[model samples]
Target: MPRMRSSSVIPHLLREQANAVQLYLQYKGYHWNVAGPLFRELHLLFDEHATTVFETIDALAERQRMLGAAAAYTLEDIRLASTIPHERGLPRTTQEMLERLIAAHHVIIEGMHEGFKSAESDQDPGSADLFARFVQAHEKMEWFLRELASEPPPTSEVTGRSSLAREKGVPAAAIPSSHAAPPFAGPPLT
Candidate 1:
């Protein structure tokens, strides 16, 4: 049996586990329902994400057990504690799936941040570390989904601007210049 220190961590752990489970289910739903030109890629990616989330569910539950808290194990427990909204019907388009996933990632990230604060407040470094890991994972997943929905960085416009700038004798280095100074021959400064 794990040693008991405080009760405050239990609620956060329960909520985190529930959220992880709900997100895992949502990813599985997307894996099954995703369709369109990107079907193969999306299908494999969603399945991989679902598996990753399933592993996270186990980790969160085990952490709760380590903290001497009872893990939430039932669908009802997840439904009640999770803020992730489940779709009753499957999304019809790749875009719809991506949008839904982006939303879910944001929800999970917020929950993780809140869990991190709660754990830190309770002085539980282990729990806080777990929550930080959750935050990083969700943020990376969110970036992946966002990339699917994103316009291709307006590549045409960017290339056009650079080409035009070059035509006008602006060096390529100056076209998308950062804070670094331009190369120039000058008298040595003291």
Candidate 2:
């Protein structure tokens, strides 16, 4: 009989499952509570995201069981293991809900990155692949949220000249400057 290798990937998988459960709950909460101009759209989006994350939780838990590790099944276990925070009261606006979703996605991405590192150290290709998929999904979701806040590039009409001038290092004196100081310089002065 082939020797059974002990996999250290279970802990990372369990933690990821816990985080996904927390995220799924938060998404469902926002779906139920979201309001405003985009309520219907946001409600549907949250529900879809929640379902997807919930699916991930199930898969992770099953994988853990397949590896002979016990999966954490209780809410308390999830809460204790999750790095994502459970917001007490959801925000009132659709935009706020979007912002909250973005924050949660960021948290998930961070956790998945850590999970990937752990899985890699354990030589667990399966968990590493799972975490990579998560990173991609979270990044796409973040891009969607960002699109809501995006505006067309400031028109040359507003700047009173083409951006080309600024790009070529034209003197500030030559450019028609707006009263609003260019949003803070690159970094705080040392």
> How much lDDT does each candidate structure score?
0.73, 0.71
Best by TM-score: 1
- Once model 2 is optimally superposed onto the true structure by TM-score, how far is the C-alpha of residue 1 displaced, in angstroms? 8.5
Q: Give lDDT for model 1.
A: 0.73
Clashes of each: 0, 0
- List the pairs of residues colliding in candidate 1: none
lDDT by residue (tens digit), candidate 1, 10-120: 677777788778888888888887665566777898888888778788778888888787778878878998887866787755666788888888888887888888888
Model 1 segments more than 4 A misplaced? 1-5, 155-190
Candidate 1, position 112, lDDT: 85
Estimate, for each residue in 1-190, the C-alpha lDDT of model 2 and write its tens digit. Answer: 2112267677777877888888888889888876654567667877887887887887889778777777899889989988776777866555556667788788888878888897898777877888898788778877876665333256444343334334433222223445323554467778
- Candidate 1: residue 163 Cα off by (Å): 24
Question: Residue 106 of model 2: what lDDT?
Answer: 85
lDDT score of residue 157 within candidate 2: 42
Best by lDDT: 1
